[model samples]
Target: MLPNYLCYVNSVLVYRSGGTNRLTGLMLAAGTLALLLVGPSVIQYLPVMVVAALIFVLGIDLAKEALWDTIGRVSREEYITIVIIVFVMTGWDFVVGILAGIVFACLFFVLQASRGRNTIRAIFDGSIARSTVRRHITQRRFLEQVGTQTQILKLQGFLFFGTINSVEDLIRRALDIAAWQRNPIRFMIVDFSLVSGLDFSAAEAFTRLQRLLEAKDVVLVFCGLQPDSAVGIALRSVDLWADNGVRLEVFANLNEALEWSENEYLRGMYASGWASARAFGRAMTGAGESGIEAARTFSGASGSDMGAHKPSTGSGAIPGLEAAGLDIPDSKGRQPAFVLDSGFENSPRRSHLQQAVRMALERTGGDAMMVGALNSVPEIEPENASSSASDAEAGLEGSERERTERRTASSGEQLPPNALPQPGDGQHQSHNQTAIQQRKRKLVQPAPLLTLTFKAYAQEDLGQEFFANLAPYFTKVRISKGQKLWERGDESDGLYLIEKGILKARYDFPQEEFEINEAMLAGTIAGELSFLSGQVRNTAVHAELDCVLWKLDGTNLDRMQMERPARDFSTFFRMLLRVTEEEQECLMSYLVTRLS
Candidate 1:
């Protein structure tokens, strides 16, 4: 075969061999056999210089095909790598060059990670700043103010020595600014919810940061750490942070840690102050003036010469406390409950931190004063007086009561088609009491009721009246042990309020096994999210034990509106409107939380 013809045959065979072409294979084999037979004679006629030229041209073609297209797009570092590999391969060996290239790539990766861009997205107080999750576990106004005194540094990406160094500078600058502004921070929250990883070196940097902050009497809290994350590993391995005076706490999530920090600030800042308020209240009886008036006068003395010592006219005046206008008394002869009435009904009005400060000042012999801007306390009307009266009037109606009793008796164990159990139901009395007790225990150390959560959505007084009046509309449900009360992705049929026994919520994911998300005790409401949003259930709930539940749905509610007495139905309708309003708030909270 001619040299060009042989080359063409070789390339064709290489390309076509990949397919299932038996004919091509046979032809190639026959051609090769023919070449073997005629090769010596043909080669004898061919010139050696021509063969050399063909080989040289083929090498050039291969080189251009491999390298030319890549040259322009390559980075400077890649250029250096290519040069090094070429030199090493030529001077030493291909194997050595490949190994060297691998090492260079690894080194580049480490260097890039060390010098990566800033991961911090924000640094602000939860009190003034909104988070992606609109709700927090804690809902105390004091906690909100404490949030202002705490700094949340939301970080993203990975944490390493170099990145941690950058973080240190950021924190130091924040501290300096706080000092200059005269609003020194008491807590520093390092939020790592968005972080991809954390190295040991970064953990060490945090230790150093803790030490630095400790000197300034600041507490450092690390939040949103997963159990298996790198920083979590480092922190778990060392107990140095737990040693005396370190004050380092790690939390499973940002919200939990922030709540803890807020609680700490609240307790620490106001413990003594509360004692002082009580003492001041006690001393007022001897001064011949009402305690509330004395406090107001002391608070209103802001323009007085605060620096100079003034004679006491038995007014129980506290010096320099009048500037802030802190009021703690109500018309009712109850313990001074600080209420901030901003006139905006929808807003969360009072700051408990301010009240704590007032108490703290009084303890330190500083005048507890109220500022002029805060002098006008907003009038808070009784929340449910009219509703209570209406309900009471309807209860006294003998005919309606007799009709409800007959409905209850006839239904016997199964509820009437459209009716629910009323609060006065004899059968549910014990279960309801048990649920109430469980709820009361939770109240002792109240979970920071997320203003965005169910508890927050239900105003205490309104919720009490609403559920009481509306309870008659919910059908009683009994679930057996291990039985599924509901499943994830099920339709939003109704809301279940547990009256007795325990239930558990679990989450099931596509690629992962089921996980136990939470345990529901009596009095907890399940399916609130789904019921409000008209969305499918996001979790599955199973009865941990035999459970008694009150299930409320639209069908039953509508039936009551048509068949029930007008007075009772009107009260329930008002409650339904309130519940809808609260659910809307919850839905907004849910949406914002997801986006954040």
Candidate 2:
């Protein structure tokens, strides 16, 4: 067997030296046949010393190639292995050397794989790494504040028995640190996108880790795994979801998993905030005071208690009456029935509570100036009008006073005693009536809804003038939940700005067997890439919730350019460009973080 292996090495050398065909094998066979036919006579005619010298030269060549030429070409460990194998083959048995080589290789591989840093590609907390989903401003702010509760471990390479221990230790250390800080981790996201494979032993290790996380009341979210993949199948074989009732959460991609974790975290936080607010409201309304017990009973009887009787008007109604264990009385006083309007028809229960709290504060003589800071109900002012009619009246009075002073200065005129008009003066009455009519017109005009979307995105207020000019170019569009705005490969007709609700864009790569999903919140623009590049859509967008969108097509933009002033159109175009640039920057930063 040892001689056969040496012969194989010599055949490889022959192939490297231009004998790369069946001709070499055929010639060798022919020589063997000739030797068999001619017997020992032909071999006796050949020079024995010459044959011996040829064999000696080939042996030296093979030895030099293996021992000296490979010295600088391979790593120190590999070179040492080679030397050891060569010495053992020379001094002992060839089989012993081969077995020794195999053992050393396995040991080296295990040592390299077990290194802690090599298994984890990157580690991120919620603050530095977030999902592609854009959320509301308040939700986004809250996530940033408590981002540390969610931890992400982006794992790479193969996971086997040796390497899995390092991953477990790293997670345990992170958990310990979090517990020490009094802000324990709530969600642990393990991203397996870059992982090539995993062994059954590694999968079992993860099951143990799951138990640890469950004991701590932490959720373990697995992402970037395909159900049909080997790693996924291996993981499924384990008792990941034991009879203890904790379910394992798995997502198709990292973005979706992260979004789910974030939503869960926010839901708990918001619920706690609501509970606190409810307690404060109860205290303020004197629900706990013994002296006010009778008053409370009387108010309850008079239907002044929240949700006791539906208010005829939209104002002063407590939001989420059912959630608060209260019911509004119907006309028959048997069933509960109520409706909320004043632009909060589709608002969440949180928004309703916020509005109710703001109204309560107003009635209790809370600071009006601090209302905006506390996420209070927005003042019922028109979007196009910066201030209310009362403000407009104040401005009119100031202008009238200035006019009187100007007339006195310019004409150098003094009012005669007869010039002092009585209450029935027609000129004064006409002027007063005209001013009142002007104020009424301002109050009655409906505001542009698209202005809300613009104000949310813009860093500073662009003012009513900008919105007034831009509004004409955009047409309002409403879509029901699950309705697709456009399919992939559709013509790039326009971009849609989300005014309300959520839009989800999914990019599917059939060949890759994975999809990238992103959520677009209100105030964000969708399909901007195709709109700007004049290309077909790469992603299909659908309404995740009932959505209100403002769309601007190329035709509308061109019309604006033709009909409006150059400066006005230019300003609008520049604003769009700025928003696109800002979004691109954010995406670039996110990609860098993930890739790094």
Among the numbered candidates, top TM-score falls to: 2
Worst 10 residues of 1 by lDDT: 443-452
The lDDT for every candidate, in the order shown, is 0.50, 0.60
Relative to the true structure, candidate 2 has a C-alpha RMSD (angstroms) of 12.6
lDDT of 2 at 309: 23
lDDT string for model 1 (61-115, tens) is 5445435655878766676676677667667876888898898877776666555
- Every model's Cα RMSD, please? 17.9, 12.6
Alpha-carbon lDDT of model 1: 0.50
lDDT of 2 at 18: 81
lDDT (Cα, tens digit) per residue for candidate 2, span 1-596: 22224675567557766887899889878988998997878778889997666566667777787888998899777888888888777778888899889988888778777875689988888766776765433344345555666788999889998899899998888668545355557678899989998998999999999888876657788888888887788887885634444457777777767666665543332233344343323322223221122222222222123112233333323333222112211111221111223443333323533443444433333211110111111223457344544454454445455566678778988876455433346767577557644433422211123333333344454554456556657776889989999999999999987655678888787758555677776646788878988999989999877776778899998998999989766766766676676556545545655576
TM-score of candidate 2 on Cα atoms, chains taken together: 0.64
